[model samples]
Target: MLQVEDLHKSFDDFKAVDGVHLSVEKGQLVAVIGPNGAGKTTLFNLICGQLQPESGKILFNDDEIGRLPPFEICRKGIARSFQIANIFQRLSVFRNVQVSVLSQQRLSNKLFHPAAQLAVNETNHILESVGLLDKNADVAGSLSHGDKRILEIAIALGNEPELLILDEPTAGMSPDETATTMALIQRLAEKQGLTILFCEHDMEVVFGVAQSIMVMQQGRTIVQGDPQAVRENTEVQQAYLGDE
Candidate 1:
């Protein structure tokens, strides 16, 4: 479980996240839905320690972690994926995931290891979970756009995180691909018991998979509740219906 209180972040006097607060319970699939520049991603960065909040407190299971570094946050059972497809273009799919598993070991000298014999056991397991096991040996750059996004998810899963923060998990995908990815996320939360918090512009995806939704506007959370409640909210309807 995680808790954020009075979080605020700014860039050169431009406030991005203004006093946002929220909580994510264990095994809960929570969606942070909002218009662009609503501070969804900025709040994530603050939670994961990518950017320090101007003023706030972040507690992971009651342990204050606002000042922790990104790696420290990952070590504490939080992992994330970006809105964009971030993968090693030249490396094999297996190798790409292997890097994530290897980093968890905290062995500074093992960065260049082939990760073939060293990480195959764990890497293969994670790849299989994301449905990319068969393509382990293929060049990452050669995969289709949807596959690349799946690979990014696999990389994040390699950490075996307790709370996964996904930024636009269905971005840049066909309807079929979006459905597949949403199903995968739902399966992970329901079967694997992984807590999920994600930001998405796709209302269909958010409402389909998220148990709860948090709606934000101009760096503030306007409403937080069940998916149907958020859907019926006048503010959310006005702000996001036309966008979808």
Candidate 2:
């Protein structure tokens, strides 16, 4: 569903992403694993049009979208979450997701209709999928850190994206929270058949959950294959996983 080829991005004298290649097919759960400077976020930015690539192409469903704006790309059916918790801190959890659903349906600014009632069912459905339905009326900022992360996922789902790009979905979570998050990720791919591409530092999470893994070093892919093949790859161990 998504293809990134020979991608490169540089900042001043340093190359953050260099000649990276990645492919994610429909309904597949793919992961990108690397050390801090591996450029996974940069690649995501390029794909989502947060930053234009210095070279190469990003294709979604056979169309070139490397130069499209972030909103345009999102409209084309790509949605993402950040490494940190991002949500409407002051709004109710339901409202945060409601905003996204409204944006998805382009109903965010209907003056005659009360936004509080807009997209009610859709908003609740997304929150329910992320396991936050009971917390829908709670103040978003009052939720636990783990709950906050899941809230962001709910917000992303408000867009009804065809391909989901999750940046460290399980980051900053306790063990139980991490388990919950991983289960949701798996459910999205298996039960709902959502295509997912993510980057993670947790080896167990990557290997245990991702169907395919891509190891990156210095902004390039060192290995890309099934979990077992990637786990046994010598270069991957040396470059990143060995330290884990």
Candidate 3:
């Protein structure tokens, strides 16, 4: 569903992402793991149009999207959540998802009437999917950290993306919350058939939920394979992931 070829990004003499190449298949979950300064987030920025790659191509389906602006890329069916929650603090959960629902529709036709009414059905559906239906009326700022993260996921889902990129979905959660979030991701990937690509620091979460894993170091992918294969790989052990 997504392919990145020979991707490179540099800052003056330093390279943030160098010669990175990977792909995410339809309905597949791939986890990207690496040490600090490995450029994992930079790769995501390039894919999402937050940062332009110095070279290489990002292909979504058939078209090249590396040069497209972020919003344009979003319109083409890619949605991402930041490492930190990106929600409106004062807004209700329903309003947050409602905004995304309206944004998706506005992309197709800005003149569509009553964006609120037009997006009502979708808003409720996505809220339920993210387990945020009951909190729809609560202010986003009042939710717990885990619930806020769930709200972020719900906002991403509002786009109905074929590919969903989550950065550290379980970050800052308790053990029980992490377990719950991991189960949620696994079930969502299977039930909705959503292609998921995520960057996670927690090895347990990565191993538990990802079918495939990409090990990155110094802004490059050193290994790519299934969880068990990656776990036992000598290079991975010598690299960052195996150290855990």
Candidate 4:
């Protein structure tokens, strides 16, 4: 559903995303993995239109989206979550999602009116899907770190996106939290038939949940394949995974 061809981006002669090419089919859960400076996040920024590519083309559903603005790209059915929690801290959990739902439906201008109330059912369903329905009335900032992450996911889901780009969905958490979050992501992909492309440093989470893995090195795609093939790739081990 997404295709990035010969994409390149640079900052002061340092190429952050150098001639990278990749694709994610519909309903596939793909993992992007690499070392610290491998440009995974940069690639995401380019794809999401946060950073314009110096050259190359990004096609979503056969439409050219490389030149679109971030909001326009989002309107075209792309939603993303950042490495850190991106949420409204002071709002109630339901309020946070309600705002996103309003934005998605172009009802943001009605936020001060009773029209915002129209999103209640949709907001509740999104929160329930992310397992945060019971916490709907709680202040978002008061939640545990893991719950905060799940809340962010709920916010993204409010957009009803066709493709979800998650940057480090399990950045900081206990093992149990990480496992729970990964399981939730897997379930979402399976049940919703959602296409996901996530960048993660956690090898266990990536291998455990991703149907395909793309390994990056110094801003370029080095190897991509199924989990076993990626695990056995010498270049991937030497460049990022190491012998361990």
The per-candidate count of clashes, in order, stands at 0, 0, 0, 0
lDDT of 2 by residue, 25-122 (tens): 99999999887878999999999999999899899999999999999999999999998888989999998998898888988886246435888898
User: Which residue pairs show backbone clashes in model 2?
Assistant: none
Could you tell which candidate, 3 or 4, scores higher by TM-score? 4
Residue range with the least summed lDDT across 10 consecutive positions in model 4: 235-244
Off-target runs (Cα >4 Å) in candidate 2 are 111-115, 241-244
Model 1 is weakest, by summed lDDT over 10 consecutive residues, at 107-116
Model 4 has a clash total of 0
Cα displacement (Å) at residue 12, model 2:
0.5
Question: What tens-digit string does per-residue lDDT give for candidate 1 at 118-192?
Answer: 767888988998899999999999999999999998999988899999988888899999889999999889989
Off by over 4 Å in 4: 241-244
Winner on TM-score (1 vs 4): 4
The residue pairs found clashing in candidate 3 are none
What lDDT, from 0 to 1, does candidate 3 have? 0.87
User: Candidate 3 at residue 53, lDDT?
Assistant: 92
